[model samples]
Structure formats: C-alpha cells, structure tokens
Target: MDLDAYVVAHAHEWARLEELVRAGRRTGPESDELVDRYQQVATHLSVIRTAAPDGEVVAYLSSLLNRARMAMLGARVLSWRAAGRFFTHQFPAALYRLRYWWLGCMAANIVVSAVLMWWFVDHPEVEQTLLSKQEVDDLVNNDFESYYSEHAASAFATRVWINNAWVAALCMALGITGVGVVWLLFQNVLNVAVVGSIMTRHDRADLFWGLILPHGLLELTAVFVAGGVGLKLFWSWIEPGGISRGNSLAIAGRTMVTVALGLVAVLFVSGIIEAFVTPSPLPTWARIAIGILAEIAFFAYVFVLGRQAVRAGHTGDISADLLEDRVATQD
Candidate 1:
C-alpha cells in the first residue's frame, strides 16, 4: 500500500470535510456531502492504519474523524429536562430499591436505642459514669430543652443541616468499609439513648419526646437511608450475584452517589423542622404531628413515586451514554 499516494488522492476530500465542519452552518446539500466525505475519510484512515500503522497522516485523520463525529452527534447540553428526569426517575428509584436496607437500619437503631434507654432508667450508676451529677442536673432541668432555643432559628437550622449532611455523607463515603456504617449508627443511637435515659431518670421523658420527635423522626430517617445505601455498597462486593465484582461495585457506587444527593434534600427538611418547629411555641401535639406528616410524606415518595420509576426500568445508575463501553460477557 503506497500510503503517500493514498493521502494525495484523498487529501482534497479530507480538506473539504474539514471546511464543511468548520463552516458552523450547513445547507441540506452540504450536510449530505459532509456525511459522505466523513465516511470516505474514515475508511481512508482505517486503511492507512492497517498498512502503515504509525504516521502523522493517520493522527491527522483520527483527530478529524473525532471532530466530525462530535459535530454529527451534537454537544450534550445540560437542561431542565435532564434535572427533572434525575429527581423524578433516577433518585427515587434508587431510594426505593434500597428501602429495605435503610428501613432495617432504622428499626435496629430504634430497638437498640430503646434497650439502652431502658437499661439506663433501671440503673442510675450508669448515668453517673457518663456524666457528673451537676452535668446530669443541667442536662435534665436546663440544657436539654434550652439547647434548641439558644441560637436563632435560621442559624440553628443551618448548623443542623451542615452537621447532619456531613454525617450522612460520611455514611455513604465510608460504607465501603462495612464496619464504618455500623459504628456510625451505633455512636448516634447511643448518644440519643443516653440523653433519653437521663431525661427519663429526671422524670422529664415527656419533655424529651416533645423536643426530639419533631425533628428526630425525619432527621434520623435520612441518616438511616445513608447508612443503608452504604451497607448496600459494602455487600455488593461480598455477594456480587451474577455480575463481576467490579461491575457490582460500580453499580452500587453510582446508586450510593444518587442516594447521597437525594439525602441532602431530605436532611434539609428535617433540619428546618428541628430548628424552627421543635423549639417553637406550637403545641407539642401539633409539632409531633407535623414531624409525622413529613416522615409519612417521605416514605410515600419512596414507595409510591420510587416504585413506579423503578418499574419503568430506572436503576439509579448514570444514563447509558455516560457509562463506559464494556465488552459483553456470558456467565
């Protein structure tokens, strides 16, 4: 194959292809001509690569082919439609699929918290070891309730949002380690249980529930969801099913990312309730009812909207075009 002679023959056609691509606007005739020239140059480049393997001309044709391909395909532009699809379809589907994991986490944490609270109520010495007498008194009589109203509502909400978001983010980020999620949940549950125990011992259990339930319900649920997604990621490698371990991890990782993003919105709502509603002058029943409504709404969002999206074949992974091409394999 005379590579130089081949180039000479097709050089003018390649130049014309470049000219059409660079012209920005194209008539129907020019667009048709561009497609034809692109195909011709692609074939020319293929032959050159097969015959000569490495050369400046092959590189030039390769670059030209890439630009023409992009021109034909058009650039991917971010739009409101893509954003809507993500939240309506992708995000909810991910949450619904991992619902069991997070729900289990929630149930287990509740039981553990209750058990610890019971133990603390039964044994006064355990509370002493955790906090000194003055500290315990302050927490029960003064600090526990006042903590909520100390800061302005807006600043407190922002603080709660950042803190809870960080914890949830850590759960997903450290979920690959398996034990990290468990440890985080354990630490959180223990703190809540201890506080409740102290309040109960002081005969302020009503106060405890009144202050915590308004925000704790949704706030803790968001944390459980994050932990659940993290644990799912960990298990993907342990039991990859029919897929390759790497592929399983990739799928779980993408889903975890989706859950992480979704949780930000979830935690924000909880933060608002915690800062504004929990410490507000509203009746305790009203505050708790609002929290319950928020919790119910979130679960409904998952089981209702999420189920439909999942049924429609969304799996929370990135769109197919965004995924890398992989060779097909048969198990």
Candidate 2:
C-alpha cells in the first residue's frame, strides 16, 4: 500500500522483466519465465492502479506490456515470411477459389471476340464505312505494327504496364456496379473484334496474330481475372449465403484485394512481352512460345498452388491478425 516501499520491493523483478523482453529471442525456460514475469508485472500495475495509481509507473508498465504483447504474438508486416506467404498461399488460393468466375469470363470474352471478328471479317466494307480509304490503308499497313516500336523498349514496357494495370484495376473497381464490369468487358472485346476483322480482311491476318499473340494471351487473361473477381464482389452482396449482406460484401472485397495485387505483377510480365517480345527480331513462333509459356504458368499457379493453398485453409482474404474488427449486421 506504501508506493515507494512497493517500488523498491519489485524493482528487481521489473528489471528482470525488462531484461527478458530486450533479450530478442528466448530459450524455452526464458519464454516461460517471461510469461510469468509478464503476469506479475501486470498484477503489480493493477495493484498500483487500485492503491496508488502513480502516473510514471503506469505509463512505463503500459508501454512494456504493449511491446511484450507484440513479441509474444509474433506480429509481422514487412517480413519475408509474410510477403512470401501472400504470393504463394494467399494470392494463389484466392485465384483458385474463384477459378470458375474468371475462367467463364475468359471463355465468354473469347467467344464474343471470335463472333464479332467473324462478323466483321464477313462484312469488311463495314470498316470502310467508318474509316476513310487512307485511314484504313494506314491502319493496315503502318499503325498497328508501328505502335509497338514507336517508343523505346523500356519506355514502351513501362507505359504498357501502367496502362494494362489501370485496366485491370478498373475492372475490379467497377465490379461493385455489376453492369460496369460487363460494359467494360464488352468494350474490350468490341475493340479486339474491330481490329481483328480489319486485319483479316486486309489479308494481314498473319501480321495481326504475330504482333498480338506474343502478349495478348497472358495480358487478356489478367483482364478477365480482374473482371471476374470484380463480379464476385458484386455477387456477394446480392446473395450473401446465410450471412449478412454487409459481412459478405466485406469478405469479398478483402478477398479481391489479393487478386488486385497479384494482377499487377501478372500485367507487368505481359507488358514486357508486348513491348519487347512482340516487336523484337525473334522469330514469331519463339515469341508466341514465350507468351504461351507465361499464360500457362499463370493458370498453373492458380489451379495448382492456389488449389493446394485453399485446401490447406489459406483463404484469399487478409490474415486474421491483419483484419479489423467488424460490427454485426442484418442480411
């Protein structure tokens, strides 16, 4: 009850606790001892609160307790272990869990592009209606191919990365609207159809495929992934599956974050292929081969490692430690 006397009596114990905390890592006995010391210090603080409530002692013990809590919990943010697990487990698991959504988006886009391409090819004069003769000639003979080579390789690659990353980000961002994602995809496929039809009609089909395939495969897949993930965000609220709509939407939004981050890297790789491989002096087959390999690697990453991570109980959502507390809500 005498504050000064109490301090003198427990000063050695307090010093010992501080020593164990600053020791960095501990042996088995030391860990047990640390826990014991922590409990005693907490009790000491409690007694002070009730009996003396000394300001300086309370503050010191509070700060010590905060550090001790983090150390015991092993909380990490900017660590190699966290970053590595994010990519290998969390990212892939998210991709695998929602594989069908993106796969369907990819398939639907391909079919729409093919159908529109065929229609445009069948009606070659339709392009002539939109563009003047000179414009068509310039696009077929110069514009499409020259676009890739006009900028320096590194500059082009960076520009392409930023542009493609933006598109993927937009897809996910607009997913909440539901219709926004569909409209974006439609516009994307429509552009592809128009261009493919123009090239095929002008007897430049080979040129189109050579320039596009080297980057388009993986590039387009990333777009579909973003679009699909975005749609998942929308669907969560519409059908929350026994949970409150707010809770479901929050979970989906968090899960989509993993896709958003992973897609940035994916888009960067495709941009490099587009800027360098697409326009390089390498044989068309080799360039296309590189693109194919990248696309396969992405899918394999999703279906293989992602699948395993999901089965191992790794959700694409942020780790529990990183999540904020939520309030209950009605469905």
Candidate 3:
C-alpha cells in the first residue's frame, strides 16, 4: 500500500472525474467515463484509508468524491411550484395522518382544563392560594382584557407568532425524550385552567371566552398537534412494530419535521386572530365565529386535501432520491 504509488496510479481517473464534474455538460461517453472513474477513485480512496492513511491524499479524494456525488445527484433547485406542493400536499398529509394523535391530545387537555376550571370556581380557597385578592380582581376586571390591546396589532402578532412557534418547535424537538412534550402540555393546560377558573369565579367568564376563544381555539389546536407529534416520535422507538427502531425513528423524525413546519402557518393564522380580531371592536359573537371558521377550515384541509394526498401515497417524506436506501423487511 504505497500511498504515493497509488496516488500516481489513480490520479488520472480522479482528474477525469473532477473534470466531468466541473464541465457542467457532458456527452454520453463522457458521462459513462465519469461514472467509471468515480467508482475507481472511490475504491482507491478506501484502499488509501486502509493502508497508508495519508491525510493529503485522503482530503483530495474526499473532495473529489463529493463533487462526483453531486454531479451524479444533480443540484437541487427550489421553486415556487415545489413550495406550493409542499404546503398543499406534504404538510397537510402529515397532519391528516396524525389527526387522531392530536385530536386525543386536544380532548384530554380540554377535559383537564375544564375540570380544573370547575374545581377553582367551586373552591374559592384554592383560587385564593394561587392568587391574592387584588391580583384576582385586577385580572378579572382589566388585566386579562387589556393585555391583548396593550401593544399595536402588528407587533403583537409577531410576538405571539414567535412565542407560539417556539413552543411548537420545542414539542417536536424535545419529543424524543417523551417527558418534554407531556410537561409542556401540562404547563400550558394548567395556565389556561387557572385563568379560566379565576375568570369564572369573578363572573367574568364571558370576557375570558370573548377574548380567548377567538384565537385560543386554533392556537391551542396547533399546540396539541405538536405535542401529539412529539409523543408519536417517542412512541416510534417504544413500539417500532416489525421495523428496526432506527428506521422507525428516522421515519417519525422526518414526519415530525413536516408537522413542525405546518404548525408555523397554523400558529401564524391564530396570531393574526389574536392580534387583530380579538381586540378589534367586532362583536364577541363575530370574533368567535371567525375563530370557529378558521378551525373548521384547518380540519377540512387535513381531512380533505390531506387525505387525498396520503391516499395517493404521499407520506410527508422527502423524495426517494433524498433518503438513504433501506433493506426491505418481511412482516
């Protein structure tokens, strides 16, 4: 394994490969030659690593291989068409597939929040322990309502969007730990329940709903979706079924990315509602109606468009060429 000798021997093939990569366009014969040389140089690189392990030769070969690989794969070009398809097909399909997970999460949180709210309303002592008399009075009378309109609509919307997006991202990013998602969801539901309970006790329940229902419906749904996806990612390893745990996790992780991106748009819409519609002079009924409509529209997108995309074999995964090839396993 004379490194110098080997380099001299395969240097021509490496140069040919580099040339083809840099040429931008090649004839059929040149393309065939490029592939042939790439294979030879890759083999030579492996031998060099095994025998001599010369850093200079290794670095050169690595760079050459990278260029050759790119030439073979072709450059990826982002376009409006691809972006449109992603939102319409990939994101929605991912949401629809995970509908049950998020829906269950939503239902559970609602029940917990409602129970807490009821408990707080029935037991004034508990509420008093959580917040003092003056704090409760301020929240019920002015603080809760004024919080929405305190800032300008645009700034408020941006702030809300960033905050909510960060929460959703955390759910997916920390989902693998299993506990992170649950902890986040619990914290959020607790906050909501505490607030709802205080408002209800003070006879300001209408004001609470009037302000929150408009944006909270969609905002909470998006959060639940993230939590569900995170939990699902955690479950992929726990119950990988027949597939290898690595493969299951890889698939789930990819799908989780899709959900995270989709939630951004969902949260953005909710932010808009919270900033503009919630604090606007519109009637409470109208504001709540708008929120309900947005929620319905989201569900429709998932059930209708998402279902269609999934049925057509879209799994919210990147194209096959982008993914590593996995060995087929029998059930």
Give the number of the best model, judged by TM-score. Answer: 3
**Which has the better TM-score: candidate 1, or candidate 2?**
1
TM-score on alpha carbons, each prediction:
0.78, 0.77, 0.80
Tell how far residue 277 is off in model 3, in angstroms: 0.5
* Error of model 2, residue 53, in angstroms: 25
lDDT of each: 0.87, 0.88, 0.86
What candidate 3 gets wrong by more than 4 Å, as runs, is 1-77, 325-331
lDDT of 2: 0.88
Writing each residue's lDDT as its tens digit, candidate 2 over 1-331 gives 7899999999999999898888877887987787777777777877787778799998988777656656654634446787788899999999999999999999999999999999988987789787898988999999999999999999999999999999999999999999999999999999989988998888999999999998999999999999999999999999999999999999999999889998989999999999989999999899889999998999899989998998999989987644422223222
CA RMSD per model (angstroms): 6.4, 7.7, 5.7
TM-score of 3: 0.80
lDDT of 1 by residue, 159-271 (tens): 99999999999998889999999999999999999999899878899999999999999999999999999999999999998999999999999889888888888999999
Give the alpha carbon lDDT tens digit for every residue of 1-331 in model 3.
6667877887777877878989977777987787777777777777777778789888888788778767765633334676788889999889988888889988998998888778877888988788898998889888999999999999999999999999999988889999999999999999998898888877888999999999999999999999999999999999998999998999999999878888888999999999999999999999999999999998999999999999999888765544422323222
Q: Which one wins by TM-score: 2 or 3? A: 3
